[model samples]
Each structure stands twice: as C-alpha cells, then as structure tokens.
Target: MSTFFFSSSKAPSSVSSFPSFSTHSSSSPIHTFSESMMEGRIENAKPIITKWNLNSSSYTKAISVFGHNRKEAKELLKSVKDLFQAMHFLVSENSPSHKLVLAQTLMQIAMERLEHEFYQILSKHCDQLNPKSVSGQSSDESRNSDNKEASEDEDELKRAGKTITEEENVSQLAMSDLKAIAECMISSGYGKECIKIYKLIRKSIVDEGLHQLRIEQFKASRIQKMNWEVLEYMIKNWLSAVKIAVKTLFSGEKVLCDHVLSASDTIRESCFSHITEEGAMNLFRFPEFIAKGKKSQEKIFRQMELYEALTDLWPEIELIFNYDSTSAIKLQALSSQQKLGDSIQTILYEFESRIRKDLSKTPTIGGGIHPLTESAMCFICSLGDHSEILSEIFAEHPPRNSTITETNIGSSTSNHSSASPASVHLAWLIFVLLCKLDRKAEPCRKDLSLSYLFLANNLNFIIEKVRTSHLKDLFGEEWMSMHNKKLKQYALNYETVAWTKVFSSLPEKSSSPIPPDAAKECFRRFHAAFEEAYMKQTSWNVPDGKLRDELKISIAKKLVPAYREFFDTYIMMVNGDRNLEVLVRFGPAGLENYLSDLFLGTHILLSSSSSLSCSSSLGCIIR
Candidate 1:
C-alpha cells in the first residue's frame, strides 16, 4: 500500500539491496551488490521488460531472473517508484539526517542526468562514419575519438551545473525564503534562533527589508511577555545596534566613540526610533555622555517621549518653590535650550489635555484638590511661557488639589487673588533661572524677576476672570489683598534690608572647617555665587521697563539673605575645627614614616638651604 516517486530518466535493472547501519556501533561483515553480476540478469529481462514497459508482471519476471526466491522475488516485484516515494515521505516527516541524505541523492541524480543529456547531444552533432575527420581514418581511432569527445562533454556539463550550485551561497536565497525560515523558527518557539536570525537579518541585509525585520523584532520583545530587565537589555542593545546601522548607512563604517560628534546630527535622527525611555536610562549611566551636559540631555529629551513617564511634577515644584536664584537660573537655561523648549511645550500640551479631561470626569474631595493636577499646572507655569493657560485652569477653584491641607484649602480659596501654587512655583523657577544666568543674565535679573512678578501680580487675574459664586467670587479680591501684602512685606518694605542685616550679624567661619574636606565645598559655593552674580548682571543690562526694576530688587534681596545665611552656617562649623591640633599631634609626622621618599626630599632641601646660608655667612665673615 506504499507509494514511490521516481524520475523517468533512470531505470533500475535488478532487485539490488544494501546493508543499513544499526543504532549500536560494531565491527561487522559488509555485504555488497555487484553491478557486474546484475548485468547478466538485466540483459535477460530487458527484451521482455521493454516490450511490457515494466508493468507488475514484468517486474515480477525481472526480479525472478535476478535469482531471488518466490517470496523474496514477490517483495522485489513492488514498484520501485512507489518504494522510493514512501521512503522520501517518511524521511521528510521524521528524520533530518535522512532528509539530508535524500537531498544529496537528488542532487547527484540531477547531475548524472545532465551529463547523460550533454553526451547524447554531442554524439548527434558528430559525423558518424569518418569519425575524427567526418568519420576519418581507422574504425578504432574513430571510436576512441567519439568516446573522448563524449567524456569531455560530460565533464563540461558537470562543471557548469556545479558552478550554478556554488553560486547560490546561503545568502542568495530570495529574502522571502529567509524571512519564512526566520518566522518559522520563531513560530516553533525557538527564541534564541529567532534572535540569531534577527541579528543576521539586520546586519547581513539592507534596504527597507531590514526596517521591517527590526519592527518584527520590536513586536516580538514587547513588555507584557518580557521581564523588565530583559526588556531593558533588549532595548538598550537595539539602540546600540541601530547606531551601528546608522553609521553604516551614512559613512559605511562602524561608529567609534571619538566619532560620535561627527555623526551627531545623523545619529540623532536615525537612532531616535530606538530611544525608548528604557534605552535613555541605559544611556544616562554612560558617564562620558552625561558629562557632555545639557546638549546631550536635551538631545535625549528631543528624541524620546521620556518626559511623559518621568514627570514627577510635584517634587520639582517643592524643590524650586522657594524662588532660589541659582535654581531659577538653571531652570531658565533649561527652558531656553531649543530642544528643551519644544519638549516642555509638548509635555505641557499633553498634560493640559489630561487635566481638563480628569476635572470633567471626577469631582473634588471636600478639602483635598488632587496635587497631581496642581503639580502639572505648577510645572507648566514654571516654564514661564504658559502662565495664561495656568491662570485659566486655576481660576474656578475650591483650590483643586487632593494633597493640600483641608484648613489651608479654605484659606487658599478665600485668598485666590494672592497667587496660585502654579504662579508661586513659576516665580521661584524663574528666579532660579535668572540667578543661573550669571553676569549675562544679571542685567536682565531685574527684567527676568519682573516677568515673574508680573505673573504673580496678575496671579489673581484668573480669579477676576471667573464669575462663579462662593469660592470663585472671592478669587480676585482675596488674591489682590494677599498679593499687595506680599509685595509690601517682601518687595517694598525695608524687610529685605533688615533681614539681610540681621543675617549679616551672624558669625563667619572658614569655609573648610577641616582641611581638605571643606576646601572643595568652599570653592563650589564660591563659584556658584560668582556665576549667579555674573549671569544676573549679564541679564539685567538688557532691561525692559518696570520688569527690569522688579527683577533687580528681588535678586538683591535674595542674594543678601542667602549669602548671609551661608556665612553664618559656615562660620559656626569652621570655629569648631580642631584641625591644627589634630595635624600637629599625630598627623603629618605620623604619616611621614610611610612616605620615606617625600620625607627624604624635604630633609635634603632643608639641609641644602641651611648649608647655603652658612656658606654665605662664612664668606661674609672672611670678607
């Protein structure tokens, strides 16, 4: 009941069988089937088989002529084609080794058929009678010539066919086959092989196909199925691999560390697809890139949507809420960067939309406004360009935050005209920005701080705009009163000056209360102050109206208090130093024994100096 498949180009002449290897290894007698012995039996049946075209009856007679007994001959009488086909089906379905052997057999048979066809064609082309000269010379010579020509023809055909096979390296398959094999491996649940295929696809191939392969790989590595660490590793490596791809695209070489700057513009564009938040976290750990400072950071912000995941808006508000001049300056520089500007604007837009949706869907608690919303609003305002939007959002409030103390929420709602949390954080950030602006920003100190003040002054503008009752009605009025009070106390009254003087009266101390440790701290604070003063002056010189005056006063007021406090704290710490006693007791000399070379050098120098002095004195006495 078995079937077989065969090519008509070749025919079996006898019922020949061969030995098969057993599973266990052993030295054993090898049996052989001799073609010479089959020749006689094949010739005997050829006439009858040819007449019948080797039907079942002819198969039986041919097998019997080959000297098999009745039962053995009956088994051999089965169609050869059917037997071969069945073997092929079994091998393909179950045995890789057998499949490989069958493949090789097919290739060899194809080669043999090609050789036979080439020889037949050559024989037809030749002159039969004269042989060498259109059937020339003797009969033996003509036969020899025909045989040589046929053999040469066979060799040429074999070489040509083999060349075609050799030309098809593993790489020469149509990309479709490659992709199918890769996907098949993946479907078979072989992740390692799938990754290997993906790696090869990306590196060994190019064009749009690589892009599709990468996308496939990306889908394969999604978060739900993968652990966080694995996902992180995969993304990071993908980024690095893509960078190499980018380099190959633009420059035809691998990217080196030193070459980063040269390819920065292109790499920024191409590698962005790989710049997931997870990947950015990986990049940040690279100290070399981080130290390049804001440019690199800004580039990451521009390339990836990382800020969405990282917007810890509330902590940031609390950090710069006090309007520290230094923090304000850093914030300003940050906002000014072109890339940062785009990112912050985008983040704000997304945040605003979210907040609007949330407010409509959810009601506020009695005293708690969701601080998350306020935090978002505060961050936007702090950027200093979105105040109009911020003011509008906070206008209609029983103060919209969940974390605000219940008692304070009432006071806050009543004092609407005073300044919203958003404005406060904004003002603080702006002040810090102005401070960071150094000499360049100093002239604008007044301008920058004044802008902040303007935001604060109109802080109640949101309240004035709203017409709702109760909390809403008090918005403008409450804010105006609080605003006026804050300005009088901090901005106009001698409070700033008086406070500065009081802080100044505090004792001063050496920056480094102990040797070495405080030395760096002292320099750091000094440099910070110097830079703040420098940038502020720089900013102030380019002034713009009342804003300029407002910023200058604020900066001066802030600097006096902050510096005086720094001095008071530093001095108190410094006055308690026992550094000199410690050094003189068991310090330099105690460690000198370990530094024999340094100790010797110092001794030699001192002796040389003393001898020089003695020599000079002796010479003077002689004279």
Candidate 2:
C-alpha cells in the first residue's frame, strides 16, 4: 500500500489534486485514504510544533514519513523562514538516530555555503585592498587605467573560460566571518583549522588598531584577573619570530653580515619599545605579577628569556670576531705575534662598541645588568689569557746591551703603579710565559758558550721591547734589574765555563823553563788553547758592541798575565831565539785584538811568523 499527504493549499497543475491516496495489491494488506483523515493528523501535529510540545508518538510518525524521503524533508524545511526553527522542531521531537542524521546533513550544507561566502567576500576585499595595485597606482589616472586593464583582463578570462590565477587573486578575509569560522572550528575541536583561518586573515587584519585594542584589554583584565598564559604565548611567539627571522636572514651560502646586524638592531629597538611603553607597568610590578593572587613567575621571566635569546647570538658574534686562517692571511705581512695581537685588538674594539651601544638602550630598571656587557667583558679579558704566546714572541729577541743600559731605564718604573689592571695582569702573564719559554729552551744551554750567548741575545731583546712599549709601565725597574742581572750572569758563566780548560793548562806559579821538554809541552798547550778559543768565540754572536768589548777585556785580563810569566821563564832556556818562535804564538796586541773579536762573527787575521815575537812576555803569539 502507498499513501500521500498534502497541505491545505491548491496543488500545482502538474500533480493530481488528491488530498490523500492509497494503493493496495494482492500481496499487501488493505489500505484506506481520505482527505479528512490526513488533514486531522496534520492538524494534530500542528499543535505539537505551534505550542512547542512534543511526544514520542508524534516524533515516530514524522520520522516514518520524512526520514525515508529526503527530498520532501528538504522541501518542508525550506518553507520555513528560519532554519533554526525547523532544527528546533526536529531536535525536540525526532529520534536520536534521526537527529544525528539531520545534524550531519545540516552541518554539511552549512559548511558548503559558508565556504562559498567566505571566498566570495575574501576575493572582493582582496581586490579592493590590493597592496601591489595601491602601491603601483598613485594618481587617479593611473588607478583608472589599472582598473580598466583589470576589467579587460577579467573579460578576457571570462571569454577564455579560465579562472584567475591564485597569485592575481590574493585573499583578504572579513574578520567577523574569519572569527566566526575560527570559533566554530575551535568548538568542534578542529584547532589546526582554526589556526589556519586566523593565519589567512592576519594580513587583512588592521594590526595597529587591533594591537592597541588588545593591549588595552590586556591591561584592564590584568588589573582584575591576569591571564599569564596569554601574555606568555604572546611573548613566546614574538621571540620565536625574531629568532626565525635572524636565522633566516643570516643563513645562506653567502651570509650578509650587515643585514644580520641591521636586523638585530631592529629587533632590539622593537623589543625595548614594547617593554618601555606597553609593558613598562607590568615589568615594574614584577613582584605583584608573580604573587599568590596574580600570574606565575613565568610571566616575569618572559622578558629575561627574550634577553637571553637576543644575547645568545654571542657565539655567532664570536665567530665573526674570530681570527681564522683567512684573517691570518690578511695580516700575513705582520709578524706572528703582531698578527695575533692585532686580531684580538680588532675584535675587542668592535665588540666593545657594539656591546656599549646595545647596553645603552637596555633598561636598567631593577638593577638588571645587560648580558651584552658581561659577555663582551668576558671576551676581551680572555685575550689576556694568551699571555704565554705573547711572552714567547716578545722575549724571542731581547734588547742588546745599549738598550738595557739606557739612562732612562730606571726612570720608567714609577709609571707602572698607575697601569690598568688589565695591562698589569697581561704583563705579569707575559713575564711568567717568558720564563717558561726560557726553561723550554734550556736543553740547548748544555753547550755553555753557544747557549749562554743565545740567552744573552734573547734577554736583551725582551728588555728592549718592554722599555720601549707600554710593557715598561707593567714591568718596572725591579723587573728590568732582575733580568739585567741574569744577562750579566750568563755572560760571566760563558767566560768561566769555556775558558777553564785554557786556564788549567797554565801552572799556578811559573817554574823556570830549564827543562826543554816541559817548555815545549807548555808552548804546545798554549798555542792550541789560544787558537781554539779565538776560533770558537768569533763565530758566536753577541749583538752589543759594548758588551763584546767588555767580555774581551775580561778574557785578556785572565790570559795575558799567565802567558807573560810562562814566556819569561821559558825564553831564557832556549838559545838563538828558536825558543822565542815556539814560546810566543801571538803578540800581546794580537791577543787583545783576537779577544776584541770574540763576538764579531768574523774570522781573525793573524800576523806573519816574523811579527809573532812577543810584545809583552805574557801576551799570545800565534803561528
């Protein structure tokens, strides 16, 4: 059996005017139909809806009729002026399964309609607020021309039956609709979708006005019930954006250092502007914000976290300041230590300038020290820690005798007390480092003559550099005096150790040389000793002329007298001056000249055999 129901209205000519109809077949039970019966049933249902009444029997009948026929159900729903009216009616009377089906259908339709409306509005606003168009077309003529061009383009697009490109059709969403959609998605647990909607609308949103309104609201709410979560979210997002921007700007095959620095400056300005203006009161009331009745301490820590984030770029800055092989190449003309020192100085100066500039802008409220200052100080102070290397270079070639004996050497010590702690500390470090260098080179000193001479040269160079540079103010007269004492001691040790053998060959007292064998042996020893000393000491260099002369005089004093006594006793034994040729290997004047040439780094010139006669009995006469 089949039955039909109709409302109390004229039926369309396309349909039969029957108020109710029924069909019965052999396989079906008998069915009855009447206009009055249908009208009565509808009338009974009318009161249920009109009075906002509901019953299980009425709901069952409605679902049985409409649930099977979606087309009729939709038509009935469309006849209502308000969609919610039908929804309310259905929700109150429909079965749970029917309600679920109805809700899903409604939501699907709503989403489709909302999406169409959203895009339509977005396209309209986007065209009107086109930043590129606005920027490009300044005058009215240009604007009209652009509008005409756009119209022509649109007509051409329509003729071609092609949609506009996404690049040409940028979106600018209506905030109200955007917010509504976001709210709907949030309520439905579509958090990611809500965020997407907000992101799309962000460009169209009036940032300045919205920011002002939000700040005002935040301030008001904070006074009554603070929302630390919201504040923290805001701060974190801002810091994260800054970090991302910096990393993006600085990261590439060819990093733009100037751009990175400019971006850093911009971030610094923006952050401080917010804190000094919008966030000042809140920051000042940090204690209150973290109090029991207020927000968490995390709220107060946000600014500090931002500070740490900003200053954390120290590692990158350190890299910039680093003296790498590239820098060494640039400064290759400079000596090794000079290259290192210059690099350090350049980094220190740049870092100091940047740090001071940055810290100057930072608010010192609550006695907070800017991390920039602390970081810069640590970096500069660290340079002094390389004193070991500096000392080695400085002491590599000490001053000659002229430099150490300068009349002004003692006058400079008074100024050392006024030296800055940094300079003084560095100087002290250099001193210790030089001492260490000397110790490391001590193994070479086992060859007393050569090594002591090397020490003397190095010590002299060190003293000269200190006296000439700022080091003089750090290492005073006492330091100079001590090193000078070492220099003299080295000179003395060379003479003592090297000449012991020569001196040992001579007897303490001269015995009469009546024995020809003893005389011949003594002369042989004398000639060998004198010649060897002259040859060896000539090759060894002592840069100071005066020091060389002094050393020569000292050697002559020891050797001249002993040789004269031996010669006087030996010459009387040999006849016809045959012994004279043997006894005098070098004249006294020649010996003095040889002594003078001890550190000249030149070959000694010997007189002819005939000129080898002793001018003084104790003097050298070399063959």
Candidate 3:
C-alpha cells in the first residue's frame, strides 16, 4: 500500500493541482472515510511534533533542541520527515479534505518548530559559528555532531508503520546539528522558512563584525573633503579591517552557510549572497572613494596601500563570493583596484613630469647634492617598495612616455623576472632625477671644476639611495654599474680641471735636475698654483665619507709623490736664499694635511633630515 501511494501516479489529480491544501475543521461528512484510509498515521504524527516542538511548555527553558535534548531533537526530525511522506499518501488516497488539511497543518507545525530551532542555535552559537571558528572547523569534526541524525535517517527505512520519503537519505556524515536541521527542513519542502531565518540572523553578524572593525561606506565627496591626516587614519583602519572582513568574518559566514545549506546549491548561494553582498560592496567601495580624493605625492603611499590590501586578499574574496548573484561584490572589488591603480599611475606620471620640469635654479653651495635629488629619490624609493602591487598597476597603465627599457632594469635582482615593468618604471624615474640634477649642477659651470663636483655629489647621493632601498632590486646590476662608472668619470674630470694647473707648475717626478734659479722659479709657480686650488676646494662639500676619502686619496696619489720628489731634488738649490721659506711654503706633509681638509663641506652644508627618516620608516611599513 505504501509503495503504491509514493508513485506520482498514485497522488489524486485534485490534491496535486494546488501547492498546499488545508481545512482546519475536523467536523466533516467524510471525516470517517479519511480516518479509515490514513489508519491513524496523522494522529500518531501530531503527538510526536507537538511534544518535541520548541514552543511546547514541557521543552521550554531555552534549551537547545539539538544541544541539551539530543534524543528529542532526533525524534523531532525523523517524525517531520515521516509526516511529509504520510501527507503524500493522504493526497494519493482521494481522501476527504479534512485529512489532507491535517497533514499540511502538521507539516506547518513541524516547520515552525524547526524554524525556532534554527534561530535558537544561530543565536546561541554565534561564537562557534563566527568566521574564525567556523572556517577553522574541520569537516571531520562537523561530521561527529550528525552521527545520531544519520542513523535515524537510515533507521526510518526499517520502521514498522508508514515509510518516509526515500529521497537519498544522508548516509555519509559531515554535518553539524544545525546543518542536519537545515537539511531536514529543506528536504521536507519547508526550505524557504529555514533559509529566511538564516539570512536575517547571519547578515547581522556580518554587519556587526564590520561595525566592530570600524569599516563603513563613505561617499567620494565626503572622503574628498577629509584632511589627509583624517584620510590616512581611515586607510589604516581599512588595511586592518579588509583582511578580517574577508578572511575571518565573511569567511566564517561562508563556511557555515555552505555547511548548513549543503543540501541545496541554489538556496546556499541565494542565502550567502543576500547575507554578505551589501557589506562587501561597502567594504570594497571605500578605496575607490579614496582614489577619488585629492591627488598629491603625499597621498600616493596610502592609496597604493589600499590597492594592495584588496589585491592581497583577492583569492579569498573570489572564493567566498563565488556566485553569479554576488558578482557585484567581486566587480566592486575589481573596480576599486582599478581606480586606485589609475590614481597612482596619474600621480606617478605627474611626479615624473615634475622632475622633468623642475625650475629650481639655486645650487647647493659648494656643490653638495641638490634638494630636488633628495626629495625625488625619497619619494621614488617609497614607490619602489610597493613593487609587487605597482607592477600590476603599471601593467594596466604602462608607464606613460617611458623611454626606459629592459637593459636598464632588474635582470640581476632576486625575485624579479628580467625587464619587469616595475623595474623599468623605477629606473625611468631615476633617469628623470639624474637629468634634473644635471640641470641643477649647471650654475657651477663658470668654475668648470665645481660643475663636475656638483654632478659627482648628486650622482653619488642617487646611487646610495638606490643601494639602500628596494630600488636596488628594480634597477639591477646593469643600472648600478652604469651609474657607478659615470660617477667615477665625473670625479676624474673634476680632478683634471681642478688640479691640472697645479701639476703643471712642477716638473714630473722623472724630470732632470734643474739649476737653482730655475728650481726657485718652479717653487714660486707651485706656491701660486697649490694655494689657489686649496682655497677653493677646501670649502667644497662631499657628504659621503667613502667618496670623500676616495677623492682625497686620488688627489694625494697624484700630487704628493710628484711634489715630494721635486721638493727633495730642489730644496738644497734654494736653501741658502733668504726668501726660501716663502718660496717653498708647502712640503709634501703640509700638502697631505690640506688634502684632508678638502671636500669637508663644513663651510656651507648642514643636514637636517629628521622628516626624511620618518618617511623611510613609513615606506618599510607600507611594503
């Protein structure tokens, strides 16, 4: 009889035509006929639902249907599954309307009870269902909670009375108590009610988690109006919040959603999308607003940071919001990344333009490094530290007006492929800086030697900046080697122009001995040449200690030996003369002492770079 009732053909046409049919009044002319047909199944099912129903006064005490009353919860789900089967049979019998009504009413009551249980468990186990816990929950561990429920699903087949729907019973176990309830409600065709309860409760948890993280949706106009300090504070909060929102809070919800609604893909996707969509859109939309804010070199670091945080979490975002309905969230995230990249690229081009068009003409006194060189190098290095994200950004907007190519970039840098876009962009920025530094060095040209010294000082400063920062990797061995060779050439040119006259005033160390009169004239010429170069080069500045020592040593190696040999050969020729002391003013020792004083920069340069240090630390933290 049970087998005949389950086939679609057995269900009477009139009952199957409508979704649900119920008539509460039991006093009907054909009530006896309906009762005889059902064989007391409806009456037996009612007591089981009413007894274990969450609202029943006996089961009250806010106890979990699945937590404290595991035995009763098992019976409740089994009874609900069985009642649904009996309803199909009642529809098939061409029974009286009252019996059909009673079966539908009993399913409604069971649905309400399950709905209550679902809400209670979600409300009670928020911590357990939180992202950190939910995502951390191993599938193996969730299976343990459903051990009893699985047996009961199998046990239904062996029951002596009416058999339940055989709709692929959950033989394998990897479901929690909540998941079991969800599957039971869903399979019985009460899934809408279960899904409604879940969406309402879980959305609040996602919203509240974002609230605690201080993430909020802000309009572009409002963000634009904010001072950079205020905007920076929000960017920092976002950096911290985006990770938790994706990895912890939303992730936890996704795992719990997938587990509970595993029985139906469409239902889980609907529920998860409805729960996380708005909050996620709000979270990702923030960076676009920030990108829309006032553009300045100062803001680029924070903007790049916002871009990177979203980029870093992209995989998790795609996995969690992996549904057509939630594609808006993914699109919003992708949109923000593009906006930030565009803004950063715009600012970078502007920065490059500024370096190219700089109008500063004032030279560093004594030809030390120009201020433009310091500021530009500092800003460019800060950008270089974010090379991973910057590469992505630069790829979309291939650095504008860029003439720098692969041979100039990080072929030798570890962790970077040859001719990477970021490497080329950084190298291009540095090349722009070098051109500007050359213009800044031009004012010292009247004294041709001072011009070379200026070029050498700025080039050395640029090299050190690259070596110390991430730019070292971007502008690889080739760039480093090229610049180092140019710096040496500049140093050599300066030595030639500055000291050629001095070297010519004395004969070579290999020159033949001369008459006393000729030797005295040589001493007089050397006196005039050496004093002039010393007076000028003494006040000149070279900030680098190693470069300063190298310059001094190079000068010493050339001048000291020649003069010492000249002085030793000619001193006796002029010793008896009364004006000898005046003519032979500097012995080789005196020349060495004065060489130490050269390039000291003491007369004109004072470094006050406290702010630059702070910015360098900021770059490290951003990277």
lDDT of 3 at 217: 67
User: Compared with the true structure, what per-residue lDDT tens digits does model 2 show for residues 1-623?
Assistant: 01111111211111121112233353432124233333333333332233211122444323322224423322322322123333333333332434334433333333322333333344345323333322222223221231122245345445433443444332211222232333332233232322333234322332332343332223333544646666566555545543433343212101211111122333222322222222222221222222223322223234334434434543542333233322332122123223323333333334434433442332222112224323433332343343333333234323111222223333233244443434433443334334443453455555666656665655565565566655654556766787788778977877887798788776667343346767667667767787787777776666656566777788889887777677656654442345565455664455666677677666664444643434455433444
lDDT of 2: 0.41
lDDT of 2 at 103: 36
Tens-digit per-residue lDDT, 1-623, candidate 1 = 00111234443211121122233222322112232332333333333323333233436323322223322222222222222333333333344444334333432332222222222222232112111111122322322221122244336446545544533221121211222222222222222322322232223333332343242233322334655455445445544544443333312211210111121233222222222222222322222122122332223322232222112222332232222322332243233232333434444444434544443322122111224434543443333343333333334212222343323223444234565544543333322322222222223233444233323323222222222222233233543455445534423332233233323332345454444446435534443433343333332221123433454455445544554445434433333345422211111222122122220112221111111111333221100
lDDT of 3 by residue, 141-202 (tens): 54333435546644643551243222211111113567888888877776776787789888
**How far off is residue 287 in model 1, in Å?**
10
Model 1 misplaced regions, further than 4 Å:
1-88, 91-104, 107-177, 180-198, 204-481, 485-623
Give the top-scoring candidate (lDDT). 3
Whole-model lDDT for model 3 versus the true structure? 0.75
Please give each candidate's TM-score. Answer: 0.22, 0.34, 0.81
- For each candidate in the order shown, give its overall lDDT on alpha carbons: 0.30, 0.41, 0.75
Candidate that beats the other on lDDT, 2 or 3, i.e. the better one: 3
TM-score of 2: 0.34
